[model samples]
Target chain A: MKTICIMCPVGCSLNVYEKNGEVIVEGNSCPRGEAYGKTEFVNPSRVVTTTKRSGAFSYSLKTDKPVPKTMIFKVMEKIKKTPLKELDVGDVFIKNILKTGANIIVTGKLTI
Target chain B: MSSFYDVIVIGGGPSGMQAAIEAKKEGAKVLILECNDSLGGILNQCIHNGFGLRQFKEELTGPEFAYKQYSEVKKLKIPSVFGAYVTKIEGEKITALVRGKEKEYFSKAIVLATGARERTAGEIKLAGDRGAGIYTAGTAQKMINYYGKLSGKRVVILGSGDIGLIMARRMTLEGAKVLKILEIMPSSSGLRRNIRQCVEDFEIPLEFSHTVTRVVGRERVKGVYYAEVDENLKPKLETEKFLECDCLLLSVGLIPENTLLSEVEKNIKKQIIVNEFRQTSIKNLFISGNSLHIHDLADNASEEGAIAGRSAALFARGALEELGEEYEISFSSAISYTVPQRVSGCGSFKIFFRAKQNFLRKKIVVRCEGEEIASKFCVGITSGEMQEIEVESGKVKGPLTVSIE
Candidate 1:
């Protein structure tokens, strides 16, 4: 279990070893580092991003995909109790936030 | 009512949208302008995801690497303006202030990708007492990656660079509490995979030589003192320490905001010096990317905005040639400043640099008048990585150097 592929910028350096449930990987230079070492050895998930509060400010969001890693602090506490006075850059708001089915959206463009 | 152009970039970001899409793919007509009101810059709040690996080899994000060059400048419609805001330049004319009146335009060759800026916290003079939670790690990464705003719960970053280690894991994934980072230099001007995935996979703590020297709060923050420098960095006074924190980001350095050339000449870190096609030593004023240095990728500032949009499309069709002697490259002392620092015989080029320390295999070499031409061997070089090499055009005629040993 070495780890390093934070997905890109050639972070490389993987090395893992699991056997039985299966996983071998080693110093990967691509194959997306063997699917990021078999999903960081079974279930890493990530694509998070934050900011939800509304009224005076708070906009960014993201999660249309990659979620699990034990649901990043229960999806940042369900996007900090989801308070978004207005959404637009791809809306969605949270069709499945912590259930980890993903779908959070609004990756920019707000007006309130 | 004036607009005529041949090239006229001026900050649309990602090196003025890759120097107006490489000077409109060389046919030249180009425009760009952009003072923000859209058109990607700062890749719309840079949402993580490694960014176009090596110019679109996958791993995208930073607004899908700036919406794939703003959808190729809107499918080749090019001609941009977006809130303009120039306000004066003189030589090849420029004026600006577009949307609220004033205008002027003209162009023949002008790029100046006005980028870099972020030092504030009283430009690292920080003593303290002034109120409101302090910021400038790209304004707390645009107030939390484009307004998601959690801003502070405990924060206290202060610069290990790489946007204070990616905002100490984006303010600890929006929960806040970062606590330590410091770095008065001893290493980590960032990127070792951003100090290993944003501060050693979130264990945080960083430290290094240390710094921050006082910043308590008066209205919003509440504590943050710091110390432990030495080795010429000063501040050791019995190793101070304070830390209660409310928020204080400040990821230290970055300069070159290239205020439209200003009688040219700069490089005591105000950058704007250029040569070898990124031009600006006057001749139609080019200057690209982090205002001409400070480029650690955004695809090397879109390959120096496609070589200053093909040398401003051969200086707007006059065929741009002139360059035979002008050598003098020089370096050594492990190299730290060398972006076309002067090398015109004009043909083959490349020379990017960075590495004033952190070598593990060494050799780099290069030279010319002193003889030994080209050499390389490098390994783990680092100085926050940039390194590039390539030199031809009669293997540098006059003064050249560059060493690593």
Candidate 2:
């Protein structure tokens, strides 16, 4: 299978295949790209970044770790349903959200 | 309050904050004038990851990247005034409207990091009624990410800029149906990673060499008439087709916000001409970041801000020397434009530029008086991303020309 590595802005085209139950990735310029290709080909995941609103204000939030790609929309639904109050930057809004082992932390500062 | 300082940095965004931090480190009394009530500028609304890859050596969301810079500004004790809208700049003096009262500030040197503004729907001459659903990609990103308000239920995005591509995925994740993305150019202007992760991952339909010919709604955006374009970018009337969409987001180009210096200095491609030190033609004045030119990455802007900040501090301290001779930097038609339109007393300086089109396995050569001073081999280059090369300035006696072969 041919895929583009989304590890960074320097997108590298990768050729991934499994041989003898071991995954092999080619055409990657870096090790991170190889890992990304393997993981993407096996079970894709991504860090979900969005906003959570409190009263009259919104705070940017992101998953502390990458979640399964198939579960991204599910995470968004969970975030939308959860009502959040005033939170400081770096505060975790939800821990182990949906058993994904990723905590939703606030990234935007409320006040300077 | 009216006061005099050694350096005054405008904007207080990613670039502005870095400039102020560097200026303060140089032992100069610096003040930052920000129009927004808070710091971080546009980065606050950009909640996506992929930022800080070069600066912090780690992938972080836009807000997280901004928070790190804001934390540095706080640690440096850089004094900044929010809600200060600078109205005019005359020589070393600046007049701003602060809390509805006129305020004045005088500085020995100034750094202009006002950044860039999105090209609007009117600039593109879109034949449409003045409707409510039409919005620039940045505005829509702000509304949805910062205000938590969905822009529309169905959308048709025009232009494949990175912001537009990102928004397509954002709106889709928020449960809005992104109908399609239309691009006038033959290829997308956004990054390859974005095209892969944002559009292709979500299976969004992206059509190149296509554009919206006319808008089809009066009150709100009901749909749009689109068609394919030829080599000359002319839409074919016969090929026009309508797509039903409640919202139309435009991801067009950006223009530098250089209104204050519009009359003072001549501009090329709507960008203030600066030297290697990020100094403008006017002495004691430095420009950096997007206001100098649209940068693809915030990391590059922060690097330019550091140079401008250090230069402004040196000028304020009366340590900067006068230029003896300067050489003009020119580029071939195959290339777009080069930053630092001119250079003086160069000793291995980097020149950033973009290609006019895509090329594979090409050589970028910089020549001075027919002598090759620098060259680099690129595996693949595109007009969407900026490229840079280093040139040694020991024997440069005439104009330097950059070309791709």
Candidate 3:
């Protein structure tokens, strides 16, 4: 498996291959790169950031943590289609969004 | 009521926030005057990752990066006023319209962190009818990434700048189809990683040496007509082709919003002229962030803000030690322009610059009085991104010049 780690500006190219039943990673600068490669090759997840319409304006949101890559669209649809009220900054508006156990919280204020 | 402070920072974005933090750290009464409802500036709408790498060494979103500085301002208990419209600068005093009332502010020193704005459709001079569905790249990003609304289904983006590329990906992620991105220059003005992830990964076509010469549509955009350009980037009318796109996103460029400092706004290649300490021609008045020069990363802007803040604080307290013998910094033919065109003979400071064209594996050298003060080997040097050089304290004297060989 080959992928680019979008973790930081370094953008290290990772080549993950299984050898002798053990997954080996190369071209990583730090430990985070190794962890990123292994997790990405196995169960990939990402912290999604998007906007939600509320009244006349919109509020920016992010998943509390990384969610399954396969469930990203579902999470985005659930967030976009849902009706939102005025939110304070850091408000956890949606609980268990996408049933992925990740909550959607307001990273930007709508009430301001 | 009119209030007084030791330092007044205009435009409460990342630069203003960081400036306030540094000034407050110097034990001076500071006040931040922001025109927007919030203090983060454009960072609020930039929700994507890849910020704060140079500062925190952590990948944080735009809002998160702004929050880091905002939290510091809160902890310092600095006074700030949002929705304050700055009128103009009168000598050392500042005046603004705050809370629907005109208020005057007195400050010993002022820091102008008033960021930049996007160049619109008119600025680019597209020969076409004025119609709807025309948006600046930043405006569209704010609409989709911040407002949660996709303006159009099929889009043709002009300019392959960072914002344009970012929106190409954002619009695609939100289900809006981005037809293609057009650029007048043969190369992109954005980071290489952005080109790889935002455009290449998504399979979005970025056509170089091409530009939209005209736009079609009246009430709303129906399509855009673009053409291949010559070496001067002038469109060749014979090679024009029309592509049907519902929306036209202009990712052309950004210009500094230095309205209050218009009196002394002597720009060096479209950027404010400043000294080593981020001080402009007026000693007490310092400039930082995008207002000084268009920085590729926000962390650089924050760092400039801190320098301006500290310098302003020192100037205000009359404790600023003079670094005698100021020398003008010059650049070679390969360099576009250098920031802080003036430098002090003593103390260490960083100077930022851009290349005139693209080069691979080039040697960047900085010389002071014919002595090589600093040199570095760079890979993939492009005109779009900024290059920096750090001047070591007391390394050399007199006029400084930087060149790429």
Name the candidate that leads on lDDT. 2
Report how far residue B289 has shifted in candidate 3, in Å. 0.4
Q: Residue B33 in candidate 2 has what lDDT? A: 93
Q: Output the worst ten-in-a-row residue range by lDDT, candidate 3 chain A.
A: A4-13
What lDDT tens digits, residue by residue, belong to model 3 across residues B233-258? 88899999989988999999989888
Q: What Cα-based lDDT does every candidate model obtain? A: 0.77, 0.89, 0.85
Clash-forming residue pairs, model 3: none
Q: Write the per-residue lDDT of candidate 2 for residues B187-232, one digit (tens) a residue.
A: 9989988998899989999999999999988998889999999999
What clash pairs does model 1 have?
A51-B148, A59-B147
lDDT of 2: 0.89
> DockQ, per-model, please?
0.14, 0.69, 0.42
lDDT of 3 by residue, A4-69 (tens): 776665566789988998888898888988987887878877777787767766677888877887
Across residues A30-102, which tens digit of lDDT does each residue of candidate 1 receive?
7877887888778867777765657754456678777766677778787777666566666798798756677
* C-alpha lDDT of candidate 1 relative to the true structure: 0.77
Quick one: ranking by lDDT, best first?
Answer: 2, 3, 1
Q: How accurate is candidate 3 locally (lDDT)?
A: 0.85
Q: Kindly report which residue stretches of model 2 are placed more than 4 angstroms away from their true locations once superposed.
A: B393-395
What residue runs in model 3 are displaced by over 4 Å at the alpha carbon?
Answer: A1-5, A10-46, A55-57, A64-70, A82-88, A91-103, B265-268
In what order do the candidates fall by DockQ, top score first?
2, 3, 1
